[model samples]
Target chain A: DQQVKQNSPSLSVQEGRISILNCDYTNSMFDYFLWYKKYPAEGPTFLISISSIKDKNEDGRFTVFLNKSAKHLSLHIVPSQPGDSAVYFCAASRYNAGNNRKLIWGLGTSLAVNP
Target chain B: GAGVSQSPSNKVTEKGKDVELRCDPISGHTALYWYRQSLGQGLEFLIYFQGNSAPDKSGLPSDRFSAERTGGSVSTLTIQRTQQEDSAVYLCASRPPGGGTDEQFFGPGTRLTVL
Candidate 1:
């Protein structure tokens, strides 16, 4: 079963526009969420993250908003640049009984920021 | 100063052969994880390790797959008697001490092709 889902397989947006990517989770026990961006043939890089306790977290041009009740979260990149074109993955993790964190990943969304 | 590193960026082998993938996590990071990505399976968790504790092998697909971490730093994943279906990109990631809050740094991944 896929606990985390990124329904959109691909997204296209013009440069300097707003790009929003969405993700949903089925496990309420997941208390932390993160976003990663990946380029072709490269590993994913950490982007932004948010805790379930907070509704939103922002860093520079990127922002993550979480809605606990809806079991959904989204990453917003404002004034998107062509450099932002990459596959985006939304991940969720929970501290297991042993105190180690285990991550559950989504299928990933490929975002294309056109210049 | 370095992020997670993985070796053998690409590997091609015949079916029935064995393959070993290696990962070197960042210095001072205590957590490590392995994931597999394939066209048919998307992305799935394989295993995880934290310091000197026992690894979480619940995500391993079968007995043929196994992993080991030495000195709580480097890790290696071994796949025995590989089949055509064993082809995929193996990704390694690492996190710091704080569970559920730290971001995971990922390696470029090793793409394995079993012919």
Candidate 2:
């Protein structure tokens, strides 16, 4: 069974608008969540992350909100640019004794920012 | 400096043949990971290696899939008796030695096609 899930397969937003991507997890143990962006033919680049202790974290135009009670998280990008178009993946992991916990990933949501 | 890199950016092989994919992580990074993304699927963890420790091979799909990290810097993933179902993009990532909560740096994946 998938421990992490991204319910949307794709999203489209006009440039200068806001874009939101949602993810959910079944594992309550997951305390660290991250978002990654991937362009075609390139590796994924880390975009942002949030710890379970914080309900929200923001960087520039990007903000990540964590709802621990709902086991859900969302990434918001304001003033989305065409360059922001890419596949977004949500990952979650918990701190462990090994300190090398493997991240559980969600099927990515492809976002298109149309200029 | 240099980010993670993978060799044989694309490979096409016949079923039942064996293949080896390579990864060169960033200098001084002590953690390496191998993952695969099948069509329309999330990034599936295959294995992980940390400094001088036994690898975490829990995510490997079958006995046919194996990986080894040498000198804790370079890694090789071997798939024996390849099946058409094994076709996917193989991704490699590395993390610096610190609290394992840091983001991982990834390499452009190797696209494998088993005919």
lDDT by candidate, in order shown: 0.92, 0.94
The C-alpha local distance difference test score for the whole of candidate 2 amounts to 0.94
Report DockQ per prediction, comma-separated.
0.74, 0.81
* Native-referenced DockQ of model 1: 0.74
lDDT of 1 at B103: 87
- Model 1: per-residue Cα lDDT over A14-112, one tens digit each: 999999999999999999999999888888899999998899999999999999999999999998999999999999988679886787899999999
Q: Mark the regions of model 1 whose C-alpha exceeds 4 Å error after superposition.
A: none
* Candidate 2 ranges beyond 4 A from true positions: none
Candidate 2 lDDT tens digits, A1-115: 9999999999999999999999999999998999999998888999999999999999999999999999999999998999999999999988777777678899999999999
Best by lDDT: 2
The count of backbone overlaps in candidate 1 is 0
After TM-score superposition, what is the CA distance of residue A7 in candidate 1 from its true location, in Å?
Answer: 0.7
